[model samples]
Target: MGFCNSCGRPIVKEDYGTNKDGSLNDEFCCDCYQNGEYTEPDITLEEMIVRKTKEMMAKNDRLPETHATAITATFIPGLKRWNPEFQDDYKTL
Candidate 1:
């Protein structure tokens, strides 16, 4: 299994995103990408971190808000969508 390039969620075949041509895109998860585009293309890394942190806490009730935020902040920037080097290529696709 690989992780989603956007949300860092674990991805299996079923969770893979779709390309514009409808082929499976192994780099991302369905929720974060579709039709070869980000579901929330306008979202910035900071916004993503905040959103994921909230979602993480909500989904895993035992996780604290601070920990969730920390986790997301630590990893989200390394994602293909947010990483500066990959951002240009990702958008062009």
Candidate 2:
């Protein structure tokens, strides 16, 4: 199993994104990627962190909002979509 490059969500084969050719992308999840493009290409890292934190809190009612935000902030930057070195790689795709 791998994590989505965009959302940092855990992903299996069935959760894999698709490329423009309809091949499995492996680097992202279906919700964050499709047809070789980000589902929310205009979203910034900060926005994603906020969104994921809210989603996390909603999914786990016991989870504190601060904790959810902290987790997503820490995890999302390391993802391929947000990492500077990986940015160029996606541009050529």
Candidate 3:
């Protein structure tokens, strides 16, 4: 199964976001996208990494902070929403 390109959440059918025409946007999650718009348009990639790392630590206390941060650093940049060109195109979309 794939993950949400924005938040790294597992991409289950119910978690999918809607396109402008109300079709499923397979690349994003409902939390990150709604009605073809980013929920937090101004959030930067660094902010997202920091936020997700904190979330990981909160969800699993046993997870080390360094490990969470490392994972976030590696994963977030590669996600479609955070990719350099994709981020630019997303704003236009």
Best by TM-score: 2
Ranking by lDDT: 2, 1, 3
Residue-level lDDT of model 3, residues 1-93, one tens digit each, is 578898887898888988889999889899999998989999998999999999999999999999999999999999998788676876786
| TM-score: model 2 vs. ground truth | 0.89
Off by over 4 Å in 2: 89-93
Worst window of 10 by summed lDDT in candidate 2: 84-93
**Model 1, position 52: C-alpha lDDT score:** 85
Q: lDDT winner among the candidates?
A: 2
Candidate order by decreasing TM-score: 2, 3, 1
Which stretches in model 1 have alpha-carbon errors above 4 Å?
88-93
Tens-place lDDT per residue, model 1, 18-83, is: 999999999999998999888989888888898889889989999988888889999999988778
Write model 2 residue lDDT over 1-93, tens digit each, in one string.
Answer: 989989989999999999999999999999999998889899999999999999999999999998998899999999998999988986796
- The C-alpha stretches of model 3 lying farther than 4 A from their native spots are 85-93
The positional error of residue 2 in candidate 1, measured at the CA in angstroms, is: 0.6
Model 3 Cα RMSD, Å? 2.4
TM-score per model over all chains = 0.83, 0.89, 0.86
